[model samples]
Target: MLAAEKSKKTRHVLGISGGKDSAALAIYLKQQGRVPEMEYFFADTGVELPEVYSFVEKLESWLGQPIVRLGSGKDFYHHLEMHEGMLPQATRRWCTQEMKLKPLEKFIGDDEAITYIGIRADEFRDGYLSLKSNVKPCYPFITDGLVRRDIFDILRSTVGIPEYYEWRSRSGCFFCFFQRRDEWVGLSERHPELFQKAMEIEEGVNRRFSNLKKPYTWVRGMSLKELIADAEAIKEKSALRKAREKDPRSWQEILISDRQDDENQACLVCSL
Candidate 1:
């Protein structure tokens, strides 16, 4: 209805994954008046960090627009059934397909939509998302030639980034298997219950796949139990490594660095 008959009015949609980049993008879009009526959404995996919710609330106030949350109503258990009890690994990421992408596709429906992505110019990964012909993907940050420093500056000038950055580098599901070894420790200490749930998922699934001895557990080599047991050593080493970076220090910066140091890339929408 917003666009004319021949024009095929495109729906302007921006997703806020409760991460700093997406939040900053929301602010940039509104402040720049790129699309005053841009629709914002957060695809909820239903197990995100509490700080994410609080951060989104702050962004909503700043953007003066509702960030509609599209949730997987059935949660992980429902999708797990569909995947036949096999836990999603990095190689076969069924979880992202079912929980993240499916919900988003449902929201757009048949509308001619412009999906704004927040892949910054400083980024090294390629998502290559969006297969829908009607849902054209656009990268505002990349097109604007805004890099990591620019994103940092925008977030700094605005809501100052989510507090979760103090602990975790990325934002997504609390039980996101992509979390670092030290982040698991942070999770256990900060949000014990959520950490417990994540560990249970690993333990239960590993037990089921014990016959094959699949090594695709949450972290690389160690189990959650082992990771927690070695938390002190890991945290101390992390502290030492972080002391070397000249930038302003935080657990988040350390985590981000750790993510880059390792070859593992976080999901675009989930981590922003």
Candidate 2:
């Protein structure tokens, strides 16, 4: 048992990533009366969507506990400057390392801790496993055989899924590079200010990295400005894709299945 290997004081930690899976894990553990002393935390990047913040607040209420908010003390722009204005991409994710993982590691310090991750049974991807011997990663969802549907059910019965799910599938910074083309359009429509900021950042990166083989952008082969210019087409394509996948399945189920196709293309620490 987990308790058997416990040190004199082993911290039980669960990270809330402002995504459905982590939020559902928190609720699931509470319902199971497991890890009553779990320390819930959110590693804020300071640039997440307003909807993500709102969802976290709602989730805290449902858990009936104050979710500790941790940060690296520096914002995204600071990290961007430190990286010579280069935007973080899938291959190079300094953003997740500096803004998310480092803060989490600092919070845990050298203390022995069990970090509960929310990667579901259906997901073939692995969570961020720290090399620090003091920190151990745990996956209750997989152990209990809970999948995507079970995550949705937990949220629906408790705090409900994040509002951003109506448009974006995952949660992270508003300027996250993992955003789909349709999600970028959704950002432009729902949070124009944030979208503008993202565009400005992309433009700044492109200016600094002008010597690169291609222009740096949030979306590959295209800039946010260019993406927004083709918003109608993107929307039409997204709608058609949804129509093609539409059937007797619930919207949540459809989204879950569609997201699985690109499961390997995400930052586990930020998305899960």
Candidate 3:
């Protein structure tokens, strides 16, 4: 073919994980006039929080460019069934592998590209690293020594932090296994229908795999029903904890502050 001798052009891409840092990175790149042609994208899990979608829309409008939404042809439910009723957990994080990374890889294909990651300088973790030789991961925040405050600054100067942060700690699926008990309570209070859906998934898996060597729930050791049964007590403990804090931040601010470092770090692609 006539085009066989031509080299493929490189592309610039940024993945927005519906969290403050990634959103800030997109804004930071734009502000610096660094990569005007950068292709921004989000790997939609289909069951993402409504606020996540709303934040994505706001970010797209601010950038004046569409953040392409990629997904596997199948939904999370289908994947759960394929996994033989094994609910995704921290150890078995196939959800991220399939729902997030696979779609991104499919989008990039054989193209040589720099995929910008948003890991802050203060965080001692590397974000997602794709095995594809042609796709290189770049940590802009790390290179620039940008920390959490810098992320806040960038967001404040642009589309602002996601509204979901008001309740949940980080961004990802609504029923993300990484969520804390308090966040689950927040979800149940904020969006009962979504919470019920998550509960159903947990209950369904447990029932289908009754003989699973290691039975699992979205929250380990506690079923959603049990969590709900004790929601008031959890809330009371959260209130007491907040009351002891000397930070004078509002209740929501305090909760978010306490939540930021609440869990072991999640996959960057899902929560960065």
CA displacement after TM-score superposition, residue 206 of candidate 1 (Å): 3.2
Cα lDDT of model 2 by residue, 170-236, tens digit: 7899988888999999999999999999999898888877898988888999999899999999999
Order the candidates by lDDT, highest first — what do you get?
2, 3, 1
What TM-score should be assigned to candidate 1? 0.88
Sort the candidates on TM-score, descending order. Answer: 3, 2, 1
Which pairs of residues collide in model 3? Answer: none
Tell me the lDDT of candidate 1: 0.78
Candidate 1 residue-wise lDDT, 1-272, digit = tens = 43457346678888888886778788888889989769999888877898888888899888877889887788888887688777776787887788788888888877889988877776666543678888888888988998766776788788886777777767888877778877788899999999888788888877777786554467777778888889999999887876775557565444434435231276676767
**Deviation of model 2 at 153, angstroms:** 1.1
Model 3 stretches astray by more than 4 angstroms:
1-7, 212-214, 251-264
Residue clash pairs of candidate 2: none
TM-score of 2: 0.92
lDDT for position 113 in model 3: 88
Residue-wise C-alpha lDDT for candidate 3, range 1-272, written one tens digit per residue: 34543337778999988888789999999988999889999999999998989999999999999999999989998998888778999999999988999999989988888999888777777777888899898888988998776677677667876777776788889999888899999999999999999999988887887887766889988989999999999999987886786567864455434435542378889888
Off by over 4 Å in 1: 1-8, 244-264
**TM-score quality measure for candidate 3:** 0.93
